[model samples]
Target: MQTALLFPGQGSQYIGMGQDLFTRSIVARRTFEEASEILGYSVSNLCFQGSEADLTRTDYAQPCILTVGIAAFRVLVERMEREPVYLAGHSLGEITALTASGALHFADAVRLVRFRGMLMRDAQKHKAGSMMAVHGLTPQVIEKECLEPEYRGLVVISNLNSSRQTVVSGQVNALTKIKERFTDLGGHVTPLQVDGAFHSPFMKNAAMQLYDELRLIPFHSMRYSVLSNVTALPYPNVNCIPSFLSEQMVERVRWQGCVQFLMERQVYNLIEVGPGSVLSNMLRREKLDACMIQSMDKKEYLQKLIKESLPKGNRAVSYAHYLKAALCAKNYNIHGETSNYLKEVAGPFRELEQLARSGDVADGNAKALEALNHILDCKMTPAIQRGGILSHIAEEGVVRHV
Candidate 1:
């Protein structure tokens, strides 16, 4: 099974995200306890009991998410049949991926992200700004809107999450203007739940300080191909990671391109090993086959699914099942009662229904997994073949034609 591991950024955090793994897995408990000592505080408490406001702070959120993300990965790693072929992360999650790939030590990573968050908080304090998610708009239209006379030089596209979802970040006034204009243009605009205007020029000060901190940490050669948010491609060398990671603070997160890169290389099954399903939702919205396993239970389900699907030395074909189901749903709008057969067959991917209904807004974690299971031992239908969505996917990347 060719797999790419994804770690989510700041907004993916929740109060009791890693508590399940910590309670059930000794490896996860050790990872969290080690992180607590490295940061000189109770990271476990911040994740298990902290309120929304506390978890939203840049300093607390970055480390807490990183710790939980890495901890969850540790618990799941022991059961994996193979290591991931690639690793990618969004915003601060990139640091976690780096640590997982052996590019950065866990202790150094926790401390560096903490310091980086503090510096970013300082930058945010000096220059007040905000971010807004503008959906149903192309990147060109959004960029054009940001450069309009009234908002020129103040606002920029901070995150290219998907073809239809772009996030804008800048001064409060500029954000307000863009939000109003985009909404009037028949687009959906929602303010992001963040403490600062991340991935924009507003973070230059933080970027500068973060570079210095990055230099102090020793970086080793990566064990897997790691994609960068700033470049939207794999790093040519391990040496470029530190500077590029620092620069990521003030650059656009080219997430859409990063996912496309993985698909182009045939890395179909992108697994999000963290708390929330944000990245998975974006992948589904783009019609890319993806799944998430955040807790110990989900990890066990994944292992069982893989075992059940690829018994007796069969080459792993679970990813093909997932891709077929996603294509079938997209092309046929196969849902409700018509998809009941799918629900019964999709032992692992039963959650695909919710994902198909909500797109990127779907909050369920098991949908993609269940969809994968449905097609594991099943054959493709004639309708899916005639639609040619899967053929189009092969030639032009993962997004569905319809």
Candidate 2:
């Protein structure tokens, strides 16, 4: 199956999330433990015992939600032997997606988001803005209304969640003034419980601060493609990671576009891996009949996915084997700095090749992709040459299976 994994952002978090997974799975427990050590707070206690108000605080919510999402993903990775073709996240969930894709270490991601949440919370204190969800209105109508003289430069669409659901963020007064206008236009305006006007110009200062933090952190090449909420497309490359992620804070989350991109790429299975069913519900609203949507939140859902293992002789597995052989036969010649090539490219490829031979289709596919990413990151190879190799691998190793 051509599968895509989705991660939920803030507002999807709730107390007691991931408790069952923590109790039932060692991998889940360890993930939470690792995050806690890095964060210097018990994420497990926060999720399983903290009050709703505490969990709702932006400073506390971001890391907590990210930890739970990563815990769930680790549990799934341990139990299921399937590699998703793409990964996407909503708002704060984007960091979770990057972490899962191997672009960021879990420790670095958790610390970065915690700092992000603090900056956003401080921004809210300074500017005092809010957000509201507008339902039953087309984005065009909402955009036009936001452009009205009374609200222009104050209110803007923050999240394009779906065709019928959009979230607006701005100064409190601007949202208040527009709510009545939207109500009169047959749109239901529900105030969101967020602290600040996220994904709007209100977050400009915070985004800049986040950019500095992002620069200090190291980003790795991703094993799987991660869709950027700011662009609603796969991230272009690691060089653009910090800037794109910083821009995501003040730019509208093009979730609807991200979904469209996935569907256009023939993703038939969509799994929401996080604390709540928010993303899954949004996907359902899209009415994609050809897509099979599943959410991994509770223990039962995890069990169900584990039980649905792929049958033997699947095309994905066969393709992975072919990829392994092709990789083995490929030349590793480079123009200069052979040491960097050996360290960054050849060494990782050797390890991934061994993983591909381990008889687990999921591991094999994931390793093959990681190996490809390593090769692409080799600066010794020309960009055009690397692109050609990637194209060849995709055509031979992936296209036929789809």
Candidate 3:
């Protein structure tokens, strides 16, 4: 099966991420250095060793997250040398994925993300807006809740995560009302740690500024498929990418539909090449068949997934799976030998009911494994460090045992 590479966006960043690779991998380290020089700031220092507050700022978070994601990506490609048939990114990550596909230069991509963050952050300077997750409720229900009488004109849908889960954004009071309605409907609701009502009309001003910056930047044709947020379809050219980048802020993040489009195109394997497995989690929920999904944000998970994806002839996949089975041998509770997970990834929890039925998929583990090799390159890991801090914190807080 052909492979697909995915990149995550804004919501994934936290302090002290990409810390291990920054120190361990020379290629990963160079990505940080290049980013720092291009941005005219010590972003690598901030990404590897800055404080939470410092890393969390929009200006800092934008380039910082992108750097780590790209660093992990470079390590993956350099190591695996696997070519993907298509590329996709969520929100801000779209630009990163496009660049990885040879659509844009790395430096131009960084500049765009920097300005993109600045514009989005400035848009809500005076607005006390927020986003809340609505679980077990359809997008229709939550969208209706926002426009009810007192809360009308305040709330709007921001992230269409899946059929069963969505993130709505609006004025504080409107969001509160929506959350209350969700609770009463026996749905789960949680608040997101975001600064503004992103991906909504509230970001119209941000779109304007980004449009100006996008016009100044140059874009090149993509080497592979690039699914866009505005179209919820594959972007065929680079000429229109700049405008789409800005317009996306004022548009809805049709993530669920995006996943559907991927599946329809037979993209069985998916890799999230940035901090956190948030996007992978969403894809897992939406996949009908149990498919291969991996993240390159950390070292452990991606390594495990890539090891799982190799062709039967490729000894690396066999060896890795052998190791996992051998190490976790005590937990299987079976006496006879297994096929080294030859069929599919065995796990519980598909998702919640119909939403899960349509959202979470079931498939063979082969595609999933292959995708890992496409963008992760062997050095990147999926395992998250237990006590690792964000880059800002790692810089100042990590102390030697001595």
**lDDT on C-alpha atoms for all candidate structures:** 0.71, 0.78, 0.66
Q: What's the TM for model 1?
A: 0.73
Candidate 2 lDDT, tens digit per residue, 1-402? Answer: 788899999999888998877876555676788889988889999999999888888999999899989878765653343567899999999999998877787888999999999999999886779899999999999999999999999999999999879999999988998999999999999897678899998888989999999999877667678999999999988778899999999999999999999989899799899898999988888899999999998567876754442223323443354345345544434333456446656676676667656755542254454445445434323223444444445443342110
Worst 10-residue lDDT window, candidate 1: 393-402
- lDDT per residue, candidate 1, 156-208, as tens digits? 99999988799988988778877889988889998877888889988887888
List clash counts for every candidate, in order: 8, 0, 37
Q: How far is candidate 2 from the true structure (C-alpha RMSD, Å)?
A: 8.6
Model 2 whole-model lDDT (C-alpha atoms): 0.78
TM-score of 2: 0.77
lDDT of 1 at 315: 32
C-alpha lDDT (0 to 100) for residue 144 of candidate 3: 78
Best by TM-score: 2
lDDT of 3 at 157: 84
Task: Give me the candidate number with maximum lDDT.
Answer: 2
Off by over 4 Å in 3: 302-402
State the weakest 10-residue window (summed lDDT) of model 2. 393-402
Q: RMSDs, each prediction?
A: 16.9, 8.6, 16.9
